[model samples]
Target: MSGLLALLDDVAAIAKVAAASVDDIAAAAAKAGAKAAGVVIDDAAVTPKYVHGFEADRELPIIWRISLGSLKNKLIILLPGLLALDYFAPWVITPLLMLGGAYLCFEGAEKVVHAFAPHADHEIEEDFDTKDPAHLEEEKVAGAIKTDFILSAEIMTIALDTIDSPNFWMQAITLAVVGIFITVAVYGAVALIVKMDDVGLHIAATGRTSGGRALGRGLVLAMPKLMAFLSIVGTAAMLWVGGSIVLHGLEDTHLWAWPYETIKHIAETTAYAMPVAQGFVKWLVAAAIDGVFGLILGVLLIPVATRVIGPLWATMTGKKAGPDGHPG
Candidate 1:
């Protein structure tokens, strides 16, 4: 009986430690996830477009497929890569992060350019209304998954960089939790956002009370504006987060310091000017400065990416396979 009691006590102690560790992991994941909020919001906002023009019945399934792909991208590919980078070449993390940040900036800037120049709804609608629904669905799903992979990579890396774990296992668990939680949160929000119009329609049609019916009608009317607002917000967030990441990376690698320092000092001065709204002022200043930097970098990168990188990618992917067996 005494030996049995000792074994039970040992198990109880182990359980307590495990429980504590779980709490720590959850706390870290939440913190890290918060840091990557911009990318998360952008991911959620962009994903719904994939479901556009699909039959109402098919939207949820399409979102589910994309969500699953996002999960695999984060947990399977990015998680291992992050761990390996942390352990072997910790120095590479900053550069990679900067690269990801640049991508985000480019994405955000492209959206901005599109908004002003306004690509005619020509191609997107054409693709959606394609004769073969099956082929269109496949293409859209593949495109969404590829896009999710890029955003997921950013989210996971941001989470990994933020975590302050003491060991490999803890880091792994924290990142895994972060990845799963973020994926669920993003997709769950997407699902809710996408189906809200249907829900509104149902409520508007079936509600027993007049007030309820009015609310439902209002919801139906409001959804498109809400989606548009979210898109704008998402783009701004991408620029802010992307530019901030690149600035931090530059500081970390000692490539640049004066500009960031100057920004901080200006923010501090601005904070002093608005003592009551100091925190908000500081954040606003920082975000604005970051956004400016992001726009500049993105504009510079646009031409290089279009002219140089695009051609190189086409060549490598054999997208230019020619009849004469020559480069197009």
Candidate 2:
């Protein structure tokens, strides 16, 4: 009887430990996910574009395919690769993260430039003109997956950097949790965003009540504006996050310290001026500074990307170079 009682106590203790571990993992996953918010938001915002012209029935399927691809990119590819890096070549992580940050800056800058100048995307037009719907779908999905791979790599790296666990299994489990949660959250939001119009139309057409119908119509009318808002938000997020990453990386590498320190000093000064909302004011100031820095860096990178790296990539891929040095 005493032995049985001891065994019961032992089991209870184990259960408690397991529960604590689960809680730790959940907290870590949430923190890591939050750290990758910029990439995640951009992922959600960008995904719907791939399904834009597809039949309503096809939209969900396309999103599902892309979601699956994103999951594979994060879990199967990035997770393991990052783990290996953390274990063996940990020093490389910061530089790689900075590279990802630079890419984000370039992408955000490109969007800003495109928005202002609005050049024709002849390649996209050509694809639509040449390909059948099924083939086009395949190509879009492929392109989306390729883009997702880059974003997922950044997400996983950011998550890995955020995780504080020393245990290999804990880190692995937390990363997996972060990846799965993000993939589900992003694609789930995308699914809803893409189908909102249909849902609104259905409600508008079929609702028995006037209020329901009005709500439906409102949703239908709101989707385009919502998408536009999301794009703007995503672009801003990319720049802010990218600039913050680069600044932090520079500090870590001891390559430069003034930019980050200056921002911190200014943020603190602003926060002190608004003691009632110090935290919020500090964060806002810091983000604004980072964003402005990101915009400038991105603008600088655009010419380098278009003129040099684009042509080099075109050459390596054996694709004909466009006038802008991108693959034609």
Candidate 3:
């Protein structure tokens, strides 16, 4: 009986330790996920366009497909790569992060250029849209997934950087949790955003009461505007997050210091100017500066990316296999 009690006590102790670890991971994931909020928002915002013109019936399915792809991106490709980086060459992460930030800046700047360009829709986007419906759906899903991979890389890296785990297993588990949480949050919100008009329509058509119908009508009217708003916010967020990442990376790598220190000084000065709302004011100023920096970098990159990088990529990849090259 005594021996059995001792074994039971040992098991219980192990269980307690396991439970504590789980709790710790959960807490860490949440904190780390918060650190990647800008990327997360951008991911959600960028996704809806993928299913924009699809039939209502196809929207959710397309989102599900992309969600699965995002899952694969985070779990299969990025997670392992991140783990390997942390274990073997931890120093590389900052540079890779800065590279991602540059890409984000480039993307954000391109969108800004496209917004003002004579052609409202880019040539590539137009080509994708003109394809047959089935093909279009496939292409859009593939494009979304590929895009998700980049944003996901940023999110995971940010999350990893924020975590203060003591060892490998804890970091891995925290990252896995963060990946799953962010994916579900991002894609789930996207699914809802894309389908909201249909839901509103259904409600308008079938509501039992006048109030319900009015609300449905309001939703129907509001969705397009909401999507437009999300797009603008998403772009702004991408620039801000990207710029912030690059600044931090440059500072961390000892390549650049003036911008970081300057931004910090400005934020602090602004905080002093408005001590009542110092925290909020400082953050706002800092983010705005970061965004401006990102816009400049992005603008600079636009020519380089289009003139040099695009051709180089096309040459390396052979005929520019479209978005993983799965028939569409």
Candidate 4:
């Protein structure tokens, strides 16, 4: 009986340790997810565009397909790649992050340029429209998954960087949690965004109360504006986050510190004047500066890419130039 009691005590102690480890993992995952917020926001913002122009019934289905692809991208592909990279080629992380950031900047800047130019890429938009619906859906889903892979890579790297886990198991657990949490948060928001119009239309058409109908009308009317707002916000976020990442990477790799430090100092100095609004002002200025830098870098890269990298890529892939005819 005494021996049985001792064994029970040991089991209880083991249970306590397991519980504590779980708590630690949860805490770490939350922190890591928070650290990847910029990338996550961009992910949520970018997804809704792929579902645009689809029939109402098809919208949710498209979103669901993309969401599943996103999960597979993160869990099955990216998770293992991250682990292997960490174990083998850890040195590539920062460079790959910078490359991803550059891509984000390029995308954001291309949108800005198109807005100003207006006639820049009508052919590409027309191509998107001309494709068979089924084929287009497949293409969009594939494109979205590809984009998600880049963002997910950034998020995972950021999460991994933020974790203070000492052991491989702990790091793996935290990353897994972070990946699942972020995928849900991003795709859940995308689903809501995609379905808001349908929900509004249904409510407006069959609501029992006048207020419900009015709310539905408001949702339907507001959705277009909301989508516009999301596009603008997403572009800004991509530039801000991308430029920030590049700046920080440069600083980390010891190439340039003055640009980052200078921006921080100026933002802080500007914010000092506003006691209550200091944090907001600082953040705004920092983002603005980073966005501007991103825009400039992207603009510079465009011609170079077109003249050099684009042709090289086309040649390597044995595809004709101007196949997509898009800036991407």
> Which is the better candidate, 2 or 3, if ranked by TM-score?
2
Rank all candidate structures by their TM-score, best first, as comma-separated numbers.
Answer: 2, 3, 1, 4
Clashes of each: 0, 0, 0, 0
**Residue 306 in model 4: lDDT:** 67
Q: lDDT per residue, candidate 4, 1-328, as tens digits?
A: 9999999999999999999999999999989887778778888888998888788888888888887888788788887887788778877878877887887787788778877875545555554544688988888888788888888888888777777875888888888888888888888899998899899999999999999999999999999999888888888888888898888889888889889999999999999988788999999999899999999987877776667777887778875444222234
Candidate 2: misplaced stretches above 4 Å?
127-130, 321-328
- lDDT per residue for candidate 3 within 1-328, as digits (tens), equals 9999999999999999999999999899999998899999889999998887778889899999999999999999999999899889999888988999998898888888778773434544744855589988888888888889999999999888888986899999899999999999998899888888888999999999999999899999999899989988999998999999999998889898889999999999989988498999999999999999999999999878866776677787664522212111
Worst lDDT window (10 residues) for model 2? 122-131
Best by TM-score: 2
Q: Model 2: per-residue lDDT, tens digit, 1-328?
A: 9999999999999999999999999999999999999889888888888888889999999999999999999889999999999999999999999999988887887789889987787754564434588988888898789888988999999999999988999999999999999999999999999999999999999999999999999999999999999999999988998999999999989999889999999999999998498999999999999988888999999889878987888778877565443455
**lDDT of candidate 3 at residue 58, scale 0 to 100:** 90
Error of 3 at 245 (Å): 0.5
* TM-score of candidate 2 against the unseen true structure: 0.96
**In model 3, which regions exceed 4 Å deviation?**
118-122, 129-131, 320-328
Q: What lDDT score goes with residue 98 in model 4?
A: 82
C-alpha lDDT of candidate 3 relative to the true structure: 0.88
List TM-score per model, in order.
0.93, 0.96, 0.93, 0.91
Clashes of 2: 0
C-alpha RMSD of each candidate structure in angstroms: 3.6, 1.5, 2.8, 2.4
lDDT of 1 at 131: 87
Of the pair 1 and 2, which is ahead by lDDT?
2
For model 2, state the Cα shift of residue 119 in Å.
Answer: 0.7
